[model samples]
Target: MQLSSLRAIGISKSFGAVAVLDRVDLAVHPGETYALLGPSGCGKSTLLRVMAGFETADEGRVELAGRVVRRPSPERGMVAQAGTLFPWLSLRDNLAFGPRESGRGDTEEIVAGLLEATGLTEFADALPRQLSGGMRQRAAIAQVLANAPPVLLLDEPFGALDAQTRLRMHEWLRSVLAARETTTLLVTHDVDEALLLADRLGLLSARPARLVEEIPVPFGGARGRHTLSDPAFVRMKAQILDRVMVA
Candidate 1:
């Protein structure tokens, strides 16, 4: 049976007098990738933070695997733009940090596989400062995946990379997430990224963001770079662009 891996019910948040999110409701099914697309300053990251338990909402609640999320849990791994990796640790050790701290016994094997999967095997002994922006983000992803989280919260993880690198990261991330069947909630301003990666794409209004529309991508499962040229993809991107522009 299908299950909801993450849910936000009537979530509302404000910073001082500036309201950010308002009665936002979101549901990400198990093993599904959901992307929240909106304009700049639309509070997409704020909502993601709330879901990750990095920030609290003034109203409503968020749940992961049916458990109320009151604090950050390793069960839900989060990856932000860049610079999330520990600068002092090598790529391999960074991947092992989470599990080792949690007392998991398979740290060596896990780190080894993660390094290979993320294409960081050669740089296993390299520190975060020794890597490029994209490589650091990949390492961060590997570090989180090492914990084997059921849900992933990504906030513009590739936003800092160049166009070419961003596209590669997108393809890499899609494959890794699919292989693990991990439920993911991505906050992105990139339309093509959302169309290419999301099982369901949601649009949020300007500020005090609320989910204004939810679109289920009809593209068959297992997408790749070629999917970007599909007519359906082009159409959906246009439609979403129109909506976001108007909002």
Candidate 2:
């Protein structure tokens, strides 16, 4: 059998007396984008952390490419909400950091490619502090992509940006992810964002979250900006909204 890009079987987690996840099973195929959506404090981030190997699950297991994910690895790249980019490092330097640290050859080539891929080539030399939130987030993703991870974990990565910026980031991100063909699992509270970015959307229940539903996005290939305005898209959002509100 072929290994999934990412897989979790009966995964559960807790913090002291509080249980955050309960037997959550999910799988993301290679080069597929899966989005997890739920209400506030629904353990979406916790689940992503588990898969990223940042936090251990109280029960169950997470696997990446047929291997158990026991700790953080470059094979599973994560992009968090904020404070991801190093404030002192320039965009170019930040992208180069991973390859340099991992002793991966062709650091310059990798950094240059990331800069161009993320449309950050013009600001390649700018420090994280000098860039806007969206730009920083893009650089953060670029930094992760530099390592050539097979699976990407995104935890509300654009939640901190303004609405307009977030939308633009969505477009840019979709383009980048498509071009790279990297497997991705995104956690988001926004229904629109989930519908726009994912090939499959999983809705989670409230605290001690479990998969409520695995919804396949109704749209066809390569969604565009206008796709969000389509009736089918709106209907899907409404359908998801109903479940998310009550989940």
Candidate 3:
């Protein structure tokens, strides 16, 4: 068996007397997108946070490429629902910030490539306030990628976008991940989104969440708008919905 790029081994967490996660175990393979799907407030984000080292697990450990994750590292970059770009910085500067801060010499090349990759080259001089929600989100993700993280933690990064824009982003993101082969762990309550993006889906129960089922998505790669209507996709969506309804 190949080693997992990111692994959550028997993770559990609680606040006060309320347990949020209950012995959750997950393994995301190299360059594969794995999503944790569940109802709202079901501890999906908590698990992602623990894996990102933003929050420590009470009972277990998180490992990234065989090293125990001790604290937040640029290697495990996280993009949350809200835009994370600096409000005052242009999109170009935002992408360059990480590399420059880390003292890398190729900031210009990295920034230019990210701008092109995210289709934000035109908006490179624009501030976050000047961009649409979707564009800002794209820039947020681009900023993270500029850091060259092997693992990307997405905490409902598209939850705030409108339906149409979100759909478009789904397609764009699929292509980006395919090209970069970034190992991703996404947390979302949207079943369709999870089904559309992930190589495998892990269903989580309500509070004190547990991994109830793991389903492989057979859609292969490069999903588009048509994917939402595909028979297999519809069936899998329905199946996952049914599981979530009962979870």
Candidate 4:
């Protein structure tokens, strides 16, 4: 079998006495987008953080490309729900920061490409406060991608956007991921978002969260607004919702 881009093996975590995760195992394959779907406060973000090495697992370990992950590194980049772009920096400078600090010679080129890729070319000089929520979120993602991480961890990155804006971002993100082929693990409570974006879905039970199911999203390539209304998509969404309700 092909190796996973990121893997959490028998992972568990707890805060004082309250267990948040319990023996959760998940693998995000190379170049594939995997979503962890669960109810609110279900430890989905905790699992993603553990995989990112920001939080250590109490019972198990996280692996990146088959190697044990010890701490956070540029090899795995995370984008959270709230935009993390520097308030004072222009979008261009924000995307350039990582590469420039890393002493990469092609910082300008990388920044330019990411700006174009994220449709932020026009807003390259705009500060985070000057942009819309969706724009800032895209900039945050672009900043992460500028590091060229093989694995991307998305912690409900679009949760704050309005419905229409979020839908537009879904389409844009689909094209971006298809082009870059970055292995991604997204944690979201939105079933439709998960169904729309992921190649597979990892359904988690309520806290002391555990993986209850690993569902394959049958929709293959570039999904659009029409995907939400498709019969197959509707059926799968209903089925997954039922499972989540009972989980």
TM-score of each: 0.96, 0.96, 0.97, 0.97
Q: In angstroms, give how far residue 229 of model 2 lies from its true place.
A: 1.2
Point out the higher-scoring one by TM-score: 2 or 4: 4
For candidate 3, what is the TM-score?
Answer: 0.97
Model 3 CA deviation exceeding 4 Å by range: 1-4
| lDDT value for model 4 | 0.91
User: Which candidate, 2 or 3, would have the higher lDDT against the true structure?
Assistant: 3
lDDT of 4 by residue, 1-247 (tens): 2224888999999999999999999988999999998888989999998999899899999988889996988788899998779998999999998898799999999999999888889999988899999999999999998989899899999999999999999998888888889999999888989988999999999999999989999998968899999999999999998998888
* Candidate models: Cα lDDT each: 0.89, 0.89, 0.91, 0.91
Q: List the residue pairs that clash in candidate 2.
A: none
What is the C-alpha lDDT profile of model 1 across 1-247, one tens digit per residue?
2334899999999999999999999999999999999889989999999998999999999988787987888888999986479988888889999999899888999999998898889999998999998899999988888888888899999999998898898899988977899899999999988887889999999998999999998886778788889888888888899999987
Model 1 spans with C-alpha error above 4 angstroms:
1-4
Query: For model 2, how does the per-residue alpha-carbon lDDT over 1-247 read when each residue is reduced to its tens digit?
Result: 1224889999999999999999999999888999999889989999999999899999999988778888998888899998478878888989998899999789999898889888889998998988889989998998998988889899999999999999999989998888888999999998888888999999899998999889888786678679888998988888899999999
Provide the lDDT at 245 for model 4. Answer: 85
